[model samples]
Target: MPYPLLHAKAALDELKLAARSAPGIMVGVTIATTALANVPGMGDAKANWNSLAKALEVEYPNLIGNAVFLSRAGWIADDREAFLNAASVFSGDLQKLSGLCYTMEGQVDQVRDAYALYWMEIGLLAATVLGYLLACQAMKLTPHLRAAGEILLARLTLLTNAMIAQKTKVLYGFLAVAGGTLATSSQSLGQLFNIQPTESAAINFERAVIPTDPPSVYLAPKRELPARPKQQQR
Candidate 1:
């Protein structure tokens, strides 16, 4: 098996694990978003929550597409070195994505803490002061979520393009090998039969006349010229 296929299989396995684990994380995000939306003073933060949700929606399908492509056996690296380079890039992207997930998780925790604090402060502070504080926290928390979501989308796009490029390289390599094999086999068979193949008439004709020659002497012009000079001497 190709090294790239092996790497893809490993990636697929990791993706499977991620798929299993994702719902729990998504549930947390959903709950947090819902909780924040209900909180009275979230203001423009609600739009950010909606944007994050839409980003996640787009991200899940892209992840699924990555898995689908990786599962394909045809997307192979041409050599061990190629596989190593691809694997390095893929691993780095995965690490970046993992870091973003961790960051998002921390952001979610912050939102939860803010939610809890809202209730605590509500009891002691005036309505106007409490609303202002909640709005301020929303302003800080929502931007981080949006940025992380955008980064995740970009990483997924890169991964998808990398897989496609690997597959294309493998396909071209296969075609080159096939063409070489066919030419070699044809030459071997010709030698074994002691058969010399003549050039096709079209090829012979093309070689017989230079493009600079007049059209009247286009056919075998060199042979025609020698015979014409002999007849004139006679």
Candidate 2:
């Protein structure tokens, strides 16, 4: 068995829900953060909330790209060290990104109880995404949340979904831009792993020839009479 396949699979299974809900979660977090941005003491920290949200925007695609790389790496069944090391490093990167969210959430909470609660919900969303990466790295799923926590998470999820439903066009535009970013990231990751297109999928870069001829051709007329006259004189 590969080193992390089973673990990664399990974590992915768990994360699928989170991944599907990320946009809504981010929308909620954005609304909450914006609401609290003007609160006392949050002046310096306002940007952090937006930054965390922006970071999260790339996270889903990053995970998907990493999963593709991991799968390709597994199939190739070579360079385990490189793959595992990259996975380890990538997991740390995920954790660090999550830490930024966690910190911003904490700072928001410090300003007011309502803001704190709002951010705690955001933290839960962060945990759902980052927790899976951590689980993949440790090969152990995090413990389930208590009943109360589950209820709150569910409600927040519902609220975010409703908000998303009301703002489809905006989310669509955001996702379009995100899709472009994901393509770039995926391309870089493919290069890192030396991933190539399958035979059927390979591109033909050879230039095509366009057959054409000149519109007209010109030739000098022979001076037959002059030539005859010169021979007669000779």
Q: What is the C-alpha lDDT of each candidate?
A: 0.42, 0.49
State residue 201's C-alpha deviation in candidate 1, in Å.
40
What does candidate 1's lDDT look like per residue over 1-234, in tens digits?
A: 544233333433433333232322222222222322233323234445445544544565466557655755654345445655665565555444444444444444444345444333322222332243344345446875656544553444344334334443544455466546546644653554574456563355555755644567445423443544545554
Give candidate 1's error at residue 148 in angstroms.
Answer: 56
Question: Would you list the clashing residue pairs of candidate 1?
Answer: none
* Model 2 lDDT on a 0 to 1 scale: 0.49
Model 2 has a clash total of 1
List candidate 2 segments past 4 Å from native. 1-80, 112-234
Displacement of residue 129 (Cα, Å) in model 1 is 15
Over the stretch 1-234, how does candidate 2's per-residue lDDT look in tens digits? 332233323433443445453334544444433333233445446566657645654775478567857677434244566776777677665555555555555544444344334434444544565554343333322345445444555565665445534343443455466556546644653454565677978766686465566548765555666544545555
Candidate 1, run of 10 with poorest lDDT: 28-37
